[model samples]
Target: MPNLPKKVRSKKLSSRVDLTAMVSVSFLLIIFFMVVGELSKGKAMALSLPEKYENGWHHWGCGSGSNERTITVLLDENNKIITYTGFLFNPRKAPKEINYGQNGIRKELFNQKKAILEYSTALGKPKNGPIVIIKPSKKSNFKNLVDILDEMAIINIETYAIVNEFTTEESQLLASK
Candidate 1:
């Protein structure tokens, strides 16, 4: 027998890869991000401050010369609330002491608002609703400020300002109290 070639053999290789752990890990990461995103949402109250005009006056009242159109609220220690209508130098009316409650500041604010609207209507002029000026004394606490602000929100006050300085008459009133 002549020399003959033996049967040739070919080797086969596996093409499959084990990716079960990778798929599971990717799904877990997606779920973690979704939960974290949902948990990060928060609620906050918005505060809008009055802007200063070119005439060196605040948009709320600082120097608008409209005493009858402004109401000042002074927050003092012991949760005292003192309110005055108009300018400190020549107040349109005497300051009144009020407390923090629905029947206290809230009632007074509503009454004042109604009076202003009625007066403006009688004069046949555009509605000049009163603006609230909130001043917190040094002894007043943060809770007092928050309480007054809440009162403002409840009454639907469209314009208001929080001033830090105290006028001479305001100091006198506080001293008298």
Candidate 2:
């Protein structure tokens, strides 16, 4: 009888995986993303346009009212802003280019507002601030419009309009610069 040789055998390991931790981690990640999405929100600004008259003219002026209390701002290309007080044909203050920011249009607005209030008081009329008329030409970009609107808001300007129409003289004025 021959003695049989003993064969070496390896032990079998378990194939089952623990999915509990993975499921918990995935839920935590989902909740974290949801919270972040809710926290981040977009901000916006509000704009109110004036009504048009049957005569193809817009009801203008604000605060104290009257045409002489109006400040016309013409936005042009190359970041140019031409400002004049009262009517274009016969202006109380002639048109001139002004910059943006605190020193430029902002400063002018403050001065104009103060002057209009004083003028109204002296005339024994309603003492109100100036009415700003904003005319942005086709050459101007959207950013210019937005920046000007922001400036108006920052200046606490209550009455302003975005007029699209431009006269021949306005175009010529824009071209002259």
Candidate 3:
């Protein structure tokens, strides 16, 4: 070959990559994460707690009967509601006794109202359709129990029942007669 520079002959080779596909993939991932983050922030649990019945069986005046909207509030060992089940009337038979506590009672009651409101809105009706029922554990503190009742009164959820898990059978039998 003629006088060609050795340096020129030793030039390094390089390859080019198209970034369009990578950019598109990154954008899609970002959108997916954003949507997932928003959805995850939604309420994870929804429930309306019921009121306790001293006599074990109480009547809900609204012709709801078995079809009535039901809400179950669970009081843990500390007398606080661990969780709640709403929109279900006539929960499984009651237990012997229930306990109620005060700390989270207000929050639980508010949660019930919120659930009822949402449910009513979804059904294109008002919040008054649903009846709230409360069940406290037997070991619950009296003060807390009364406080929950007072809160319900404040909200005007008058149609309610206090049921013990074990007494449900007896109450049903009495109603049949």
Candidate 4:
């Protein structure tokens, strides 16, 4: 009877998988990477601070002749900009309030720069633009500082500084205005 080979059947196997755990792990990893990236992001502005020397501060406007060619810009709260020329104790004129636009700080810078150039030429010295000193108060925000820096580039200013501290007179001037 052919070794009695009859009515033999094979067992079938199911082909199904559960992907819920894998999907959950993938979502958790995505969220973790996103949070880490956000935490690593930085918001800071680049400022070139002047070097210190043993014999007082060695920087622009150190000589007596260049004193008259300095322009100081004070950035207070509420987008207020106060500009003046020469020393804080003896300003060339009262600190004037100006805005930020084509008819504001830009125009003031151009006019002051022209005046300084003319003065330098008149004194038989090489024509040089004014040395701008930007002083941002603690209450001032970053946007105003950036705007002033942009103005510097747009006006083609050759020399400038970002001073962090303010003199007593400068503080008083800001308070008065």
lDDT (10s digit) by residue, model 4, range 64-168: 546678888999999999998876556775689999899999999999888888888888876566888899999899999999999999999978988877777
- Give the Cα-based TM-score of candidate 4 against the true structure: 0.65
The parts of candidate 4 lying over 4 Å away from their true place are 1-64
RMSD (CA, Å), each prediction: 6.4, 5.9, 15.3, 7.2
Greater TM-score among 1 and 3 belongs to 1
lDDT, ranked from best to worst: 4, 1, 2, 3
Q: Enumerate clash totals for all models, in the order shown.
A: 0, 0, 22, 0
Q: Over the stretch 62-148, how does candidate 2's per-residue lDDT look in tens digits?
A: 333466778888998888999988767767899999998889999998898888878877888754667788889898999989989
Q: How accurate locally, in lDDT, is each candidate?
A: 0.80, 0.80, 0.52, 0.83
Task: Give the local distance difference test score of model 4.
Answer: 0.83
TM-score of 2: 0.64
Between candidates 2 and 3, which one is better according to TM-score? 2
Error of 4 at 149 (Å): 0.4
* Every model's TM-score: 0.65, 0.64, 0.40, 0.65
Candidate 1 lDDT over residue span 58-155, tens digit each = 43545443577678899999999899887666678679899999899999998888887777677675566768889899999999999999988988
Task: Judging by TM-score, tell me the better candidate of 3 and 4.
Answer: 4
User: Against the hidden true structure, what lDDT does model 3 obtain?
Assistant: 0.52
